[model samples]
Target: MNKQQKIIIISIVALTALLAWVVLKPVQPSDTATTTTPHEAASEHAHDHSYDHSYDHAQAGDTHDDEDVVTLSDAQAASAGIVLDMVKPAHIFTMLTLPGEIRFNQDRTAHIVPRVDGIVEAVTVDLGQQVKKGQVLAVLASTGVSELRSDALAAQKRLSMAKTIYAREKELWEDKISAEQDYLQAQQDLQEAEIAAQNTTQKLHALGAGTSAKGGLNRYELRAPFDGMIVERHLSLGESVQANANVMTLADLSSVWAEIVVSAKDLGTVKVGSSVTVKASAFESQSSGVVSYVGSLLGEQTRTATARVTLPNPDLAWRPGLFVNVEIVAGEANVPMAVTTEALQTVEDREVVFVQTAEGFRAMPVKTGRSDGKMVEIVEGLQAGAAYVTKGSFTLKSELGKSAAEHTH
Candidate 1:
């Protein structure tokens, strides 16, 4: 063959080989395409088969088939872990709570004031000192007593002279040696002197000066008027105190007043003679008493009425000015159907309680009456001897909500 022909034949052979490679060679998958490989697909398929078998085994262990499924629309008719006592005839006490303060009884409180103006000579009672009735709390000096002593001395001198003259005149009259007018005049003078002296003595006694031997009027003695503890002292030794000035405040803590500020709305519910329970944070003590007084007028600022509870303070644990909580028993209903407070729940604005039934717990709309802390009186919608769920009703309620949402969907 010629050289050119041989070259053309070789070129055509090479071109045909290239065309065959382009047509028959495998094309690589694009980056955007699914990356699943044959080996991976096989592995996933095997895993899925094993997972189905394990799920079947788990379902077999449960024993509950699809036929055992039970659905409840109401929470009260659903099964719950907690059970409640059947409502029955019982007494329910209604309580009204109010914030209060510990106070000294007005009748038991005394303000120690000097009857006469004087400098405080000595303070016998300190603040918070227990004192007895007629106890000398403090001593003072006053010019008022000195004037009284001077008046008494003058009266005594006049009385002595009058007595001497009267005795002489009486002896003369008995012997018929004096005129009747002269004897009568002498008797009148002696009577006048005695009256003057008695008046002076009375004045001293009223000034609380009868105890002092020295006619020296030290108006300094300030005594407690009643058996009580000195809650406040406004005077110190050598401090000049004015007449009618408050020296100390005393209170008989054996009995105290629990003063509560009640809202005007609660005024009708609170009345005199209502039972009251008082609690204070100052001491771990609780006291029971009765409402002794209720203010007819409302407070100018708060528009609340004041109610006083008389509580016995034998231990003196309750002090004045201590904040306290007061609970008053407003009323009571006898033989009322009642249930635990926890059994009652609020559904919207209406009150409800869970009533247990064969199906589950069914929410029973109930009318609630007075609540006595632990239990609430059922006014309507529940019968005596009906079992109910007290606790765990919340869980049932949540389940009911889920069911409701599903229905809505």
Candidate 2:
């Protein structure tokens, strides 16, 4: 029984192995059929992916081409009417500008003061009135005037009595009816009387009263010391004024002081005897003067120094305290190259300008010099009257910056 079962199991196992081989074995194609191996198919897929990735990369690069490119042609520039210019020469004046005010010259100003304490009985001159030297400006009344008059009158009476006594004594001595001592005394008395009369007359003169035969009463009169306009008056009619009180302030406006405030750093340029041009707002004309004084002390708040120039004011048009713009011409250049201030451009740390050339507007580097308000002196790399782009310089500068950025890429 065991031999027969073993024979059957061997046959079944053999059949199972044959079937397994047939099911598991790969199928074979005919010679006419084309096919790819696993490795070959994988290689083909990898090649396709590489090609697609390269194509996409190329498309992305082309998409951004319009943004990074610029096409500036000579024809387009010429169509825009860009032109070139030649350099020229001109004079350049260097100036120090300052603000100033008009003031009365101290040398030509006067203060009218009363000589005696009195009530101001009359004020003949008013503010802004023109007066001549020795002109009576006011009349004052005081007890001092009455005392002076009484003393003069008393001296006159005493002199007359002494003269009468002396004449009588001299007549007696001449007739030999009196001693020689008496006649001597009479001569001394007459001399004394004449001396007293002269002393009284001199006192009256000192009090500003005339020594006339009529001998009028003395009255205090305030007079102008010089020929000038009365700019201020402190006394009114019937106002009590003290001795040595200022009654009026007078100013001779033939000349005035132009006081200017200059920065301390510019003190070197502003010196005495320098020429100055003062422009006032009230008048359309400009006044020229010489610098008379430069203050040594600096202002604490403004850090500026005061300078004064004396200018003639014959027309009295320049009033005191009027604001003015002052320009002090420090020096001049005979043939200097300069340009308008608007033509200058700044790029980062570099100061630049557009120069008109054969090609077009080309950016230029320049060194600059002193500048007035309207024009600037060119120290290097620019010529006078060379038509650099003054108005549209910023537009050109922006385009140049864009172009520079493009070249970096």
Q: Which candidate is the best by lDDT?
A: 1
Considering summed lDDT, which 10 consecutive residues are worst modelled in model 1?
A: 63-72
Q: Relative to the true structure, how large is the alpha-carbon lDDT of every model?
A: 0.80, 0.78
Candidate 2 global lDDT: 0.78
**lDDT of each residue in 1-409, candidate 2, tens digit only:** 6899999999999999999999998867764265778898899999999999999999887644432232346675455444444445547778877899999999999887776678878899888999999898988876776677777777788888888888888899889999989878877877887788788778767766544434235467778778899999998988998878888899999899999998977898999999888998676767889999999999899888999999999888899999998898777774467666767778656677777665557666788887654467678887666767656566666777787677568
Clashes (backbone N, CA, C under 3 Å), per candidate, total: 10, 0
Task: Please name the candidate that would achieve the greatest TM-score relative to the true structure.
Answer: 1
- Candidate 1 regions exceeding 4 Å error are 1-89, 215-219, 281-283, 334-370, 374-409
